[model samples]
Target: MHERVATTPSLMIKRRLNATPAEVFEAWTDAKLLMQWFGPENVVTQEVSVDAQVGGGFRVVMRENTGERHEVRGTYSEVVANEKLVFSWSWITTPERVSRVSVTFKPDGAAGTILTLLHEQLFDEQAVKGHTHGWTGSLAKLEALFA
Candidate 1:
């Protein structure tokens, strides 16, 4: 494993969700659910495909308010039911700059879940900044879905 230096650009988001771990996990792996909240603000997800298993692939296609289309696809490297997922992340426009994303759902007190998302191995600070904005937006939508 490569140890990340202090300057290695990465993003981490932690939020308390008003749902169980299983529910939160399902929201990530289910196509229909993902379509509802898979993109940043002003980006409407048009299609979603998920095979939530190790070595499986997932793709999400979205359209921005300006009518620009964006697609992201990745392969699952690790999947732990109701607990965690690790996947590669690459946008169609910049497929050469592949990154990694990991999400973990931990049981919080009384039916709630503490979700932590760590996005690493980004190409640079710019990529990290962009992804941070996008992910935070999407996660906010997810939070509202379970709220």
Candidate 2:
């Protein structure tokens, strides 16, 4: 007989932005634009570097109001202009726990973009919860950009 173990579920998040797919994609790939709305509310972006292509990498550092710094780095696995992007994500502090993130941009009617984000391979349930919180906050900031 073989034993099996259960795994944590992947996180899926969706948002609708009042902008075109190109604009939403640019906000993700362009370092300058990303820095403007990459982190949670009240978290200041200290540094941002992005190479928006397959096999390229990105790094973002944010400082909280309490001066705590959080850094995340990732490598691009797939990139489709204004359509989709897939990447590997790992925290600088815990590179051993690598995860994958995929984002798809779909045109909604004529002006809005429907953004779907799926984050998988999380190490544990705690990671899923933490990422859910972080992503929710980040997405809110991203949404504000188009408002």
Candidate 3:
């Protein structure tokens, strides 16, 4: 018998947005909008391609000021407009390793949306740490944009 092994890290992030759930979800689904604020200040996406429907493909190439590049690609597992999205994410540089991510948008009250993202199934310690930092930093930028 073979033992099952975990292959990706997990992370959770929550933030409130001034926009509606529909608008927040749209920012996540649209490649152009995602590219505008995807990474840290020192990093920027050079290109993004996304097909937000089930089994659809998505890819993004992010480059740092020093020209280092990281490529991420995945396929959507589930998509529910304005409410939730589920997808399998992979770092192309780390072949055969994949992570699961779920993002939910909830109407917080009258005029704002609460966005929560959960990423799971990580492989190693480094991955967990890296993703935690990345998600926290990225969400901060997103919040700043709305502020």
Tell me how candidate 2 scores on lDDT: 0.93
TM-scores for the candidates: 0.95, 0.93, 0.90
lDDT-better candidate, 2 vs 3: 2
Candidate 1 residues lying further than 4 Å off, grouped into runs, are 1-7
Better model by TM-score, 1 or 3? 1
TM-score of 1: 0.95
- Rank the models by lDDT, top first: 1, 2, 3
Q: For residues 1-147, what per-residue lDDT tens digits would candidate 3 score against the true structure?
A: 999655555778899988888888888889888887787778888999989999998898999899999898888999999999999988889868888889999998876899999989888888888888877877777777667
Q: What lDDT tens digits, residue by residue, belong to model 2 across residues 8-67?
A: 558999999999999999999999999988887779998999999999999999999999
List the RMSD of every prediction in angstroms. Answer: 1.9, 3.5, 3.7
Query: lDDT tens digits, residues 13-69, model 1?
Result: 999999999999999999999999889999999999999999999999999999999
At residue 6, what lDDT does model 3 achieve? 50
Error of 3 at 106 (Å): 0.6
